[model samples]
Target: MNIVKSVLRATATTATALALLAGPCALPATAQTPARPAALAAAQQAKRPNVIVILVDDMGFSDIGPYGSEIPTPNLDALAANGLRFTQFYNSARCSPSRASLLTGLYPHEAGMGGLDSIVRPGLGGFQGRLADRAVTIAEVLKPAGYFTGMAGKWHVGAQHGTPPKAVGFDRSMFQKGGTYFPDQPGKGRTFVTIDGRQARLDSPEVGKGEWYASDMLVDWTVRFVDEAKVAGKPFFLYLPFTAVHFPVMAPADEIAKFKGKYMAGWDQLRRDRFERQKKTGLIAADATLPDVLPEAYDWDKLPAADKERFDTIMAVYAAAISRMDKAIGTLVADLKARGEFDNTLILFMSDNGGNAESGPDGRTGAAPWGGKYSNIFVGLNWATLQNTPFRYFKHYAEEGGIATPLIASWPAGIDAKVRGTMVREPGHLVDVMPTLAELAGAKYPARFDGHDIRPMSGRSFAGAFDGKPLTRSVPIFWEHEGNKAVRDGKWKLVAQFGAPWQLYDMSTDRTETRDLAAAHPDIAARMTQQWNDWAAKSFVDPWPNKVDGGVIKGRLEGGKAPGKGKHGKGKRKRAAQAAAGA
Candidate 1:
């Protein structure tokens, strides 16, 4: 393991040589990345790549330029242009579970995070509200194999279960349960983060007063960690999970200005535009059909002019949030290049889940300078339906719209040139990240860690996909959250909404799941349902309505406020929502 760092540091001389070969202005002016010199590329590739896994919150499949969005994500677009874009990547349908899966290379149930971390059902083993002790994180696997592990941003997996990031494996970390974009925003409680194991204000003097943005803060810490890794002379494994494009959504005014009034065309047209773009960019199958706008989505044409204006402004904020994150990414990429680590860094960008429509179909947007819980804007079903273009349902469902996520990987020295700027049609899940990093970093997935028998990884390494090979997954992918269950077995997908019977789709032909084949092919549906049930039972998944706390726990879809709540109860629900959003 120690020898790996030595080889990497020695290989740095080759990167330096290449830099000297180029003039003072080393970076290209255009969007196209320059070709790497053969010798230098070989030298860097021989050593371990600096691994970065970037997860964004509540973003949809087509929310970025590389995917299908009109919103400018120049940095992300550049990465996709220079590397690989995956068309069929999927995430667990919610936040905490997805993070658990991404870190541990296991299904959410196996990682002990089947529900939101805020929902703690004591004695109900699978829904423990945190990561399982037996699961090992990518950081844990990589650190012992000569990597400096660091993390910045939301760490929603409960600290009570498997401890926080620093204790798990990260050498340095700064994280909170949820997002509080502006620390100084009045009436909104500040989110104190655990930094290097110490609790501190998220907005320190280093971040200038009244200038604390969560995305920038995350990137600043990432850059600092990278510099620290350089001093330690080790390859770095940095996890940056940004809390952007999520509820309580906010962005800089100037950024919001850039897209104000731009969404007047509304969800209907924007979704169609994105769908067309997806087909044109080869991010979706050319013959693929777009599913109709969700039934819950508002009719843009029916909305009053004032409502249209309000909707446009809020969507602008959503766009601003994404574009701002993109700008921060550009900064990170530039810093990597300045250190001559850009080519050797394997950067992976993905979303935790699909678009959120938590506040309801109509959505809600509060007054300026959002301070309290539920006080910020939610794009709601209308805009969220657009965000997950050509798909059905929003977040919290076991549908393509909820689970689908765009995954982009960039490694100038590692990815094959033949696949650059091309879309990969192979289906992948968040679980694959750990194994991929383990393979690229030459790290071993241990059988035992900290005297506990570790859970075997459910994911296989998709590193071959980087070289333009197929991601030949042997087993089917499964999902279950709040009673929404699904199984993706090759071309067939069996999905069921909470309290609903299974609906099957042929993913090879109808990736958007517009057509239900279950009635026509009942045999396939029954077989897959059996497979899912068998897997779920063995994987610690409690059946819906299972006993918990000595009572029958009825299913509460979306985990929102109870029904029949009047105005006062509505206020309480909002407060609860605020707490949950931050939690």
Candidate 2:
């Protein structure tokens, strides 16, 4: 019996050794098999966490409640309460460039959206056209890894007839052509869109009604996509870029009614209140200062009564629109929880640019005139000031008010609750999302995909932050659009407006950029400036000439009126009549 038992024990030992040799584990005899590295083990167990990126259009750094605004964004506050909030998150100061950087994991110029253009036109030197066929998006990299991808929002990277989301690797897409909320405009050629491709249109009058806010529509489509993806048993990535709180200041009447008198205290007091709240919430430093009063053109107290009312109403509408957006976000969160996907999903919420202050001195909102060049319902400048609360400059500039944003990321299954409620001061940008998602999903970024030789990713992954580890970025981040440029290497950032001298700041101590350290740190500033110049020479493309000149008027309007419009006098009208007669 002892001999038989010995034979059985020997057989069992042999079987165990062989199994270990063939499987992930190795036999004890096989030269001490090493344990898997922590990073590799974490990547293997990533489970392709469902990715939902929610982008709010034209929202300011302090727009949300948790970010120290008077706005009642309970849903967004709830998101921050349950997730990680980033105080130093950033994006480009404008729309198209930010989207371009976010998707391609490269600087805006590297992705071919060097500057804003409604359409690529001739004579634009350096305008590389839309997102070049060479850039590889996150969708393209993740699709082959058995993940479904969909985008339902603003896709402003390209505007040519054939350059919709599908052409850029999105499996299912529903997006608008331009950046406005004009669904009633002619569908095929007149700008406003409700289509999947270039041809499809929403025939239902329900959606065509003027009351249908763009944010609500976007959220509806997003929720439906989530449901459909779950039914198909496929993990999905949904990019919902809602065009809310942008110009035109339109919202459902009911939502607008809630905030009718909310801003009657005027921007001066409101800015102070918001700034104090931000300090109390620990969102900003105690030493931070309120921006100096705006230039004479923006003196709120000097405006006429009618103008004040007009601006007030416009802001009221804007606030209502964002509140509705918050409600929609709440519904989406509830839906995800209902489906049992909330715990495992990685949901990220951010704005595509800082609050916009593009309204000209004449109070024209956005790029288009109200009633569009054809109507009288123009949005005024009051709302623009309110949009960029507690900040100096607005969209199109490189100031903190224009570029800073709030980022909230929630993942119950992966992020610890204690760490979730904490605010992270590590600086991160929109360009980092693609690589981070790729690393978290264990997906490879191929050298070539779909007939394009992709450029190597310029962004480093922040996935280490999920496990509460310090994130270290090695490369210097750069930005350029229409000649506005910036470079950040650690705490030092160098910036320059178009046609202006470069300025430097130590972001660690002066995030609001009150002090320019250009003279103090001349060597560091010069080195960083040279670095940006080198990057620009490589990635630079000239702005689209025709569209560029059409959008922004170079200098401020004189005499408080647009060019070609005569002064408010009969002599000006007579000169206009003479010119018409000559024509």
Candidate 3:
């Protein structure tokens, strides 16, 4: 039955891809059914093309220019102009969970990544960084298929040495043990770990110089890897999870200058302008109502002179970071085209999570607690609101602003340029990437590997959508990271934060989630809540076993607290010790 299903799926996919290539054609016998391509049917399948998954950190749905932000993301805009861009995609509400699900094709908890700031420790059950040994990563699965896999940028899933990218199957890796940026650190000057069996810090002092932009560093490495792979005649998997535009707002001074006075309009006017652009560009539907402007907590007109100056500087720096990242992406794409590998390479770009609102309305300007080495400054809620544009809440919540992200997939060989301007409204999530990539690569997903029983991937392949076919998720999608829970079935999404009442939305009509349908659809809400609970239980979602004395977990800048001080103090201390030992 599985084999039969697979064959039918392949046939349908081929037809869809061909139909896209042939332009408009007569409707198939069933309007809902996909059309198969004759060329794809006759062609013998070749080895999988190289996969480049570029995951950016803390980017909002509308932060990119194509998505209606004022930010100049020309590179991302170009990708949208030439490939498939998704409008109704979702991700876990926060970082680690999103990365975990993207890599393992399972909910974060199911993959042993369920909380924030929890480093993964070896031999420790239910801690972050543990990839459930049972779950197979894309790198591991692709290794046997003869693909050279490499990853750079953030690796938040685990900080333990043994579980770094190399252990999971990457032949090469240069990644940050945690999500951070440090322009002052010595050597790679960027606090990063290089894993090729053993974790070693890169000893390149050039990394600390003001001239080094982390985004460019990652892209340079990617280009080198691509060149090497081509020379070796091998397909490669380059997982570039960039930390650009995250926080401590660092970017080239020139990039920062481009937007010097751009954000003088403040978030209020900036958000309004972005919404208008979204409507004009067909990024959002014409009838879609613009969310009410967030009420001003502080009267900007009445702000003290010093306060105003600080606010403006932070916003400007934040914008600069985004612009610089965009420029770097353009460079990477250009390199691919120059190398003649652009057409066939499948490029997937998305954010690890939504815009961060942690800085509050006032931006944070100080050395990150882990020391100024990891970050120089932090942008708070005021800028976060602009980043999240047209959505409510921010990172760490299951609201649209937190989980919704722009997903761009570009491949000259697979996607139709004519459809480049179109948006796929079908609801997709991070977990879907694994299966989608597997189908595209014709890679097999094993039931068991490395002496552990693997859980079947909960995500269904979305390759069908590339050809304009509707994607049917086999299981209701679920999420449970740090008590931010949600369940999506069809167009309806049910969600709740820790200690909050469950809220529901009809994603088709209310993707921004301004309306709470829980009151109108009690029965549907009940079903979704029950499903979320069931899935959460199966995935081992639980609150931290210990509590901070004042609900304060020490910040890394303040010398992160040792494990086991407050509630789960022992657990925390043990994990910290393991992290120190290079677990």
Go through the candidates in order and give each one's C-alpha lDDT.
Answer: 0.76, 0.65, 0.66
RMSD (CA, Å), each prediction: 9.0, 11.8, 9.4
Q: Write the per-residue lDDT of candidate 2 for residues 1-583, one digit (tens) a residue.
A: 1334324333433443354334232111101112224664565555668899998887888778888878899988887887888888888777877888888887776777666535354444335557765576777666555566788777777646335666555667777743344455432343445454544444344334443556767777777778878887767888998867654445666677788777767666787788899888878888876666443224556555655565566567667767888998888889889989888889999887776545343444333222232222223333444556556565666667667888999888877656887788788888888877776665656666444477777776666677777766676777665556688889998987666688998877777777889999899998998898787777654532231322431123323433222231111111100000000
Alpha-carbon shift of residue 213 in model 2 (angstroms): 3.0
Question: Which lDDT tens digits does candidate 3 get at residues 401-503?
Answer: 8888999988877765556556787778888888776656545566766446787776766666666666665567777654566888888989886656899
Off by over 4 Å in 2: 1-40, 117-126, 159-161, 178-198, 205-211, 365-383, 541-583
- Candidate 1: residue 115 Cα off by (Å): 0.8
Q: Which segments of model 1 are wrong by more than 4 Å?
A: 1-45, 160-162, 186-189, 206-210, 369-375, 546-583
lDDT of 2: 0.65
How close is every model to the real structure, measured as TM-score? 0.85, 0.82, 0.82
Estimate the TM-score for candidate 3. Answer: 0.82
User: Model 1 clash pairs?
Assistant: none
User: Which of the two candidates, 1 or 3, achieves a greater TM-score against the reference?
Assistant: 1
